[model samples]
Target: MGKPETVRLVSKEGFEFVIDYKAACVSNTIKNMLSSQGNFTETELGEIKFPEISTPILEKVCQYFYYKLRYTHCPDVIPEFKIEPDIALQLLMASNFLDT
Candidate 1:
């Protein structure tokens, strides 16, 4: 079989996340980056770099992307996404930057 479609996201601290394209596209910003009409670097390389987002926040954003994908259409109840109080502000900023 052909290789699965994926995208690489790099955080400011050099943490890299390799995730399915479908999952990554859960974020509107990422979807546009990957599928924009113009020829951008991210589209060509299948990678996005978050220079202002830290590793922990980026990790949580990635997790939320997958969680949103998995639970979006489920009939069962979806669990809340947990965030530590300390990182809440950072996560919110990252989420805004990602347009999640």
Candidate 2:
């Protein structure tokens, strides 16, 4: 089957974020989920559910994915990736789990 242009990521709260496939691949874990040799359900459906990540954290992760994609080649002009203090710990945990 042809590669999907986008992927759906579902947060623990059931919020879904549809992001570009290239952007989603910024996370090594997600890249593996979609491209691994095993028959991953995510590979077939192009969707993944993060049960440990809340909506807000997942949203930030999605944003970071796009940001990383946009600034990957341009090292000089990359902006800081901001995280709100309230969710900073949670975001870090999620990022670690996702291997982003």
Candidate 3:
């Protein structure tokens, strides 16, 4: 697969993350979107917006996504990170976003 284009993604809680199509492909919604023929042209539907997640959790989510991207060969175990309730909600939002 060639390098995909960078795209902006927004969470429902108003958190926005810039990710490559491949990176966002980790998200099932994204993957499903790509699975279709006209996904590339579908702009409005592609941005992920998770309303329940707070900024802090979205920060953590971005870090997690970075970590995962940085270490593709790493183990599957999720590292334990202390987070606030609001952030935890964001984590859950990201988890659900990626369907992991």
Candidate 4:
């Protein structure tokens, strides 16, 4: 059987975001979770649940993953990854946890 090319990330509020597998792997935590030695269910199903991460924050994290992947190699051309002032704290905590 072929592995999925995308992964589903479900947020605390039950919102789901389907992203490219490569993009999802931007987060070290997620990469580990989907690795061959990681949890069998997640690796097989291509789905991960973030019970502690809110919908908005999870969406932002997903966006950052693609953004990072797009710009990681070109240092000077990378644009700023914006975070809303109100959710800055929460986003920081999530980023730290994901080790992105």
Candidate 5:
């Protein structure tokens, strides 16, 4: 792609993340967002809040995004992310929070 275009992505839980539109597209969730016209909340300067994910997971995802973004320059397969069963419960809570 030429300089990558801007894209908007929102999680099922209602968390909207505004990274480099290209960077965000690295996510399958986002790629699908681009394919289908999904509802997104936008403000000036492309500010977005991804409430679906907590600060912790969002932080981790962001880090992973950056890594994948640069992975082409320095190729290496990294392990997939996994969370504890108990923490998975908290994620469920977070997901429910966005729904309600």
Candidate 6:
């Protein structure tokens, strides 16, 4: 089979996350960046750089993306997504930025 469709998301500190394209598109911001009409660097390179989001926050966002995709149509009960109180604000800000 051919290579799997994936996209790279780079955090503010240059932490890179390579994830499935479908999973990445769970975020409206990422989806637009990858599918925008203009030929931006992200679209060309299949990599998006989030300059304001920290590595830890980005990682959590990626996890949420996958979690959303996995359980969007599940028949079983979905578990609550936990977040530490300290990082909750940051995560919320990042999620707002990502438009997830």
lDDT per residue as tens, model 2, 1-100: 3349889999999998999999998999999899988778898889899999999999999999988887888858777998889999999999998899
- Per-candidate TM equals 0.91, 0.90, 0.57, 0.90, 0.46, 0.93
Whole-structure CA lDDT of model 2? 0.90
lDDT of each: 0.88, 0.90, 0.61, 0.90, 0.52, 0.90
Residue pairs clashing, model 4:
none
For candidate 6, what is the lDDT? Answer: 0.90
Candidate 4 on 21-57: residue-level lDDT in tens? Answer: 9999899999988886845888989988899999999
Those runs of model 3 whose alpha carbons end farther than 4 Å from true positions after fitting are 1-4, 13-15, 39-46, 74-86
For candidate 6, lDDT tens digit of each residue in 1-100? 2124989889999999999999999999889888999888888788888899999999999999989998999999999988989999999999998899
Residue 87 lDDT (model 1): 96
Tens digit of per-residue lDDT, candidate 1, span 1-100: 2123989899999998998999998899999888888888788788889999989999999999989998998999999988899999999988887788
Model 4 regions more than 4 Å off: 1-3
The TM-score obtained by model 1 is: 0.91
lDDT of 3: 0.61
Runs in model 5 deviating more than 4 A are: 1-17, 37-50, 73-100
**What TM value does model 3 have?**
0.57
Candidate 6 clashing pairs? Answer: none
Measured by TM-score, the strongest candidate is 6
Candidates sorted on TM-score, descending: 6, 1, 2, 4, 3, 5
